[model samples]
Target: MSFSAFRILAEALTGHGGWKPMWREPEPQARYDIVIIGGGGHGLATAYYLAKEHGLTNIAVVEKGWLGSGNIGRNTTIIRSNYMLPGNEPFYELSMRLWEGLEQDFNYNAMVSQRGVLNLCHSDAQRDAYVRRGNAMIMAGADAELLDTDGVRAMYPFLDFANARFPVKGGLLQRRGGTARHDAVAWGYARGADMRGVDILQNCEVTGFLIEDGQCNGVETTRGTIRAGKVASCAAGSSSRVLEKAGLRLPIESHVLQAFVSEGLKPVIDGVITFGAGHFYISQSDKGGLVFGGDIDGYNSYAQRGNLPVIEDVCEGGMALMPAIGRARLLRAWGGVMDMSMDGSPIIDRTPVNNLFINAGWCYGGFKATPASGWCYAHLLATGKPHPVAAQMRLDRFERGLAIDEKGAGPQPNLH
Candidate 1:
């Protein structure tokens, strides 16, 4: 059912009897033209674009569980396109643009809030670095502004400005960067794709890949063997495990990144805030809860849980940045597994096996890059060529000695 003011009014006047389910639940087909592994944000977006933009309707997104039951629902919901590298800036700018028109394009309210994102700088060197990043963002067609101490204070006066260890100096503000309703994005994309005849096969686990002569033809699933003309995997944290079924070992590691939210109170935070001296970042949700997170646990695993040390470190960072929140009781905490690559960048390209495409290695940028990643992955699957903006995200970048270390995190996945 189409949603609008008129619809809402009619439903209210008619005793609210005209509501409908968002999308249909379908069984897996015997075969499809394309098969996508993983029903997270990226997979759903890919299916949507394949049908909406490329007119390839015979696609299926196979998931081992319910839709939006993965990292898509467990994130802090932040979105931004602030990068200082040539290989990433343009691609993320495309994502930012798509986020601007996403609701209109999909005909669903994902609550794309561009309230703004402020990265606080604690030192002169940090401020200079933000200036460079802001310039890069502006050059890539994204909005950015450099805010001094007074400017940041005006926006967030509750911060600890005089802390000697990590005093607030200034901040880099991206007026278009903010959060969204994370699950709504997935549901909207899923509904859009379903309306276009794309089958969403939830609970259909991909047990193995059907490959012969170094060409992937289909997948072996829990339901049955579903053959396809092409196969793509956008399995997020399960990237390595899913691809390993095809005998391809990836240069990626999985780590758990925890997030927390406080009990709902009166609205306090106006926009997103990130501490420069540490890894903590926070924003207030629409329900008046303080949403926040920090660094990944210093280990590799698929478990969706973290230890106490990282929690302590995150709380310390939050208190150092904003002492007012030191006494706020955390309501709940959750973790999302991150697929971190060697150079802290994503890979979107054809693998050694023919007819197989890979879209993985998105550390912390998956939610923000959802639209652009899907557009580029659909472009590649449709035309057998990389999207111009995502041309540099090839799987062979390491062999060519061109690692896009956007965070200067080196080859260690934990460091990134």
Candidate 2:
């Protein structure tokens, strides 16, 4: 269905009726039961879950910029739960379950399309790795299929099956994994939380944390100070800056990730395809646009300027898989800063401060894990204890020499 029609249908189902506020003024001196910093998907979802699930209605989500205008707004919007490590497997599986019911629960369609995701393997070792991933998925009670070269070709007829350089051998296919409308995800949660009386403060940059006796009590923002019983940081790219302002240093490197989209055409790709060897992936949107992205920019910079190498590499991967797309002209490209954790997983536990909590890292997989992240984070905030789903993502995991390094790609920040 067209996005316009989808929007109307979403409104009718949600009872939110329609879109209204583009921007809302911030209240200067509002005291809330919970204050969540950085109004991205995680923050907004946390607020929504806190109110909807736990009945913690007095909450506020403070964003430095406009709502859904941060990394949550800038991601490639792929959703999947095919994880390798034990620590990450179950949590992401929980996220996948949440994605399945989001539309019914929120009464808003985020346009979550589960066209599936195929993680391609180029060699024997890679094929074995894919098998392991598939096994993990099955063990976790998630749907996954191990495909051979013939299986790959049968599913994706346009691929160059005979290419010697990176011949298609097989892949681990997660049938439930796919994409969601990134902006709508933020708006859906925002609307849901707003309906529950949670304040969403936009354009209100947080300047510092109000800590007393080594515990956070509130926050100081550009608008004014607002006191809260608890605070959670869901800031993605600017996480380090926010933490530093609060007199803490986290092992997160801020870097930029870029994605490209080609001019629309009749849909060809039916599902998300990731070429592991090439470090790239492509998925055709419902709009017929070829949405694609690749590895990080490989440097630490807040600047969102994307380098040419990764872009060229991504396009080359596209050409290798489906040569027909080579004729498609590039329309536009954009970038967003990602706060990559040292272990390539999220940090969703209480901070050293008594009442402060954290839900950062997330790397590139934050979008898919939004619901579960929020659910677990709200549990952490409400009960003052880490939920079973997120017990492995403690802040002290790195310091305690017990990192959950899921990618097995090493401790380097940019591997994922």
Best by lDDT: 1
Cα error of candidate 1 at position 190, Å: 0.3
lDDT digits (tens) for residues 244-324 of candidate 2: 887778879988899998899897888899987787788988899989998888899798768888888888888787787
Query: Candidate 1 — which pairs collide?
Result: none
lDDT of all predictions, in order shown? 0.93, 0.86
Model 2 TM-score on a 0 to 1 scale = 0.94
List clashing residue pairs in candidate 2.
none
Which 10-residue span in candidate 2 carries the lowest summed lDDT? 21-30
Indicate the TM-score of model 1: 0.99
Measured over all alpha carbons after superposition, the RMSD of each candidate to the real structure, in angstroms, is 0.8, 3.2
367: Cα error in model 2, Å = 0.8
lDDT of 2: 0.86
In Å, residue 109's CA in model 2 sits off its true spot by 1.4
Can you tell me which runs of candidate 1 are displaced by over 4 Å? none
